[model samples]
Target: MKAAITLESVTIRTELRPGDIGYVIYMHGDIYSKEYGYSLGFESYVAESFVEFYKQYDANLDRVWVCEHNEKIIGFLLLMHRGKAAQLRYFIMEKPYRGIGLGKKLMNLYMNELNSLGYESSYLLTVDELPAAASLYKRHGFRLTEEKPFSDFGKPLMEQKYELMLR
Candidate 1:
């Protein structure tokens, strides 16, 4: 099922404003998955403390873009670009906002932006534990580039990587 959805036009910025105070918490709460840590060759169940998350965000806020609806943040996209390669460091939607195709909308916008900015390709890594997310990536012309076992949450988990060559 789908509903007509509207997203607030976001202002992309390289500067972190005062409103970014709790950004670390919001970003990491969804990104840190014991399941994902294991799949990426990290310790099983690796969880970052508030301080650690904040430090990371402080160092990388310039690569992040936030999505706000009606004055509330509902999602964000963290990007990393190097030469011709772009990585989706983080992408997520809060529970109340999931499954209305916002993800696809956000990705399409990002892809167009990246293309205009001269990126030739994009890639992302996710765990098999998140089949729905993997499927979303697949639906968008991403092809699996790798699958392997990794330790997350102190247990072995399967990690999947996907890539898309852009125009």
Candidate 2:
């Protein structure tokens, strides 16, 4: 189990321990399907990405933050090195955990981590369905870099890429 750090009654863990990966995958799969009508393909894609990240994991340049309440993970975000840039991934918060400033706190933690790692910029890929997250990204200085129709999940979804220059 990862050590938990409390922030205003919420616990945020920076380490990815055993069973954390499964929980992350399950949470994404279940939440996305219920919230956006996404199919299993999305979960499969997540699993693949997790596997790839595991294979090439770099402790010095990669991090995953898991947010918890009452010892249950309620949200998570990832920062992975991508050359000179950091890639933000799997940023999500359970519905019950929204609107309480946890999202903002998690984001701030992510940005601080990236800055400490010396990343020049950070980027993330997200769908248009997540207006709240998109708004948060925008508020954090991320600008839309690309948008395109993506059907990889068996539906016509608008995929967007956002980037934030740290320097």
Candidate 3:
């Protein structure tokens, strides 16, 4: 993981079709394991075939973005578009590139895109233990919408939901 903030060698863009689903699934799985201590049970792709996952992701490709570094997929963010409101379902950065601002860049891009799409607000959920993540969301104009105890991977965790009104 490169900890530098340079994205010169990295390319970030929207996922347009099913062809990019495999990379999204693989990167997302690895990132989730590193950040959340468990995979999203995304066992199909990069293990078996990605027929089912591909279909699902493809159906909502407009809400997904892929970041590639050195021609390999590194990270991704998934957004659930709901008319005027958007929910950030997942955001992850793999272990090797933890300290870099890739997470922030992904988030800024997501918010900017959503705003341009006429969204009035966006929401994201994060665990309270991840102070860095929570701070990042706050720095980007997200406020604490709610906080609650939630179980992740069978472990007790305090989850926080944040909202950013785009106006």
The C-alpha stretches of model 2 lying farther than 4 A from their native spots are: 1-7
Task: Order the numbered candidates by TM-score, best leading.
Answer: 2, 3, 1
Reference-based lDDT, each prediction: 0.61, 0.88, 0.67
lDDT of 2 by residue, 21-50 (tens): 889999989998898888899999889998
Model 2 is weakest, by summed lDDT over 10 consecutive residues, at 2-11
lDDT per residue (tens digit) for residues 1-167 in model 3: 94654666567777645556665556656665676675454433233433433354433323666777776667767666655687785566666555666887887887777766777888977777778878888888999989999764346778788999878
Weakest 10 consecutive residues of candidate 3 by summed lDDT: 41-50
The TM-scores, one per candidate, come to 0.67, 0.93, 0.73
- For every candidate in turn, the CA RMSD to the true structure comes to 5.8, 4.2, 4.7
What digit string (tens of lDDT, one per residue) describes model 1 on residues 24-142?
A: 35444444543244232232222243233346443322255667765666676665664577777557666556766677777776666667667778888877777777887788788
Candidate 1 matches the true fold with a TM-score of 0.67
Model 1 local distance difference test score: 0.61
